[model samples]
Target: EAGVTQFPSHSVIEKGQTVTLRCDPISGHDNLYWYRRVMGKEIKFLLHFVKESKQDESGMPNNRFLAERTGGTYSTLKVQPAELEDSGVYFCASNYGQGRAFFGQGTRLTVV
Candidate 1:
């Protein structure tokens, strides 16, 4: 089974710009979740997608952030008009019935 993969590994953008992060989960896994941990903050859930439907997205910080899962394959997270506080490490995880999950190395987004 293939593990989750994230692109770029690191990103630096100016304030008020946009950034898109991608995540490819293990094949056949129906559970994909997005999480992040900002400086001095614990890892926090951003959203979850089961198949093509978004199971939960209550953890999304604000309207500036958007997440989508098309065709139940891979997912993408976009932050529009990024802010300084948006700087953090974004992780994607996939679950396959087991309590353990596979995580990507994460994409570090820094807004200056």
Candidate 2:
């Protein structure tokens, strides 16, 4: 029963560069979700994946951002040509029908 894990903890890049974030959910869990909060804004949902299928991705901001969960295990989120506004804490959460979800420490992306 490993907890969700994220990579890099923090990243700083130029306005036009690209960055990729990773997430590893707990074992035996089928639900994985990506979320973030920017500049005092509320935590927003990015997408949801159940197993190898994407259950929902309507929260994705634009084409510049992409998310994938391969083999229903760990997931990845890539931001291409990043922007300053993209600077924020990216969190990955997982739930297995449990009332509470586990979250990673989060990756703080700082696009300058």
Error of 2 at 76 (Å): 0.2
Error of 1 at 56 (Å): 0.7
The prediction achieving the highest lDDT against the true structure is 1
lDDT of 2 by residue, 1-112 (tens): 6688999899999999999999999887889999998979999999999887889999999999999888999999999989888999999999887547889999999998
lDDT of 1: 0.93
Per-residue CA lDDT of model 1 for 2-79, tens digit only, reads: 679998799999999999999999888888999999999999999999887899999999999999999999999999
TM-score of each: 0.95, 0.95
Model 1 bad stretches (over 4 Å):
none
Q: Worst 10-residue stretch by lDDT in candidate 2?
A: 94-103
- Each prediction's total of clashing residue pairs, residues at least 3 apart in sequence or on different chains, is 0, 0
Instruction: Count clashing pairs, candidate 1.
Output: 0
Give residue 23's error in model 1 in angstroms: 0.2
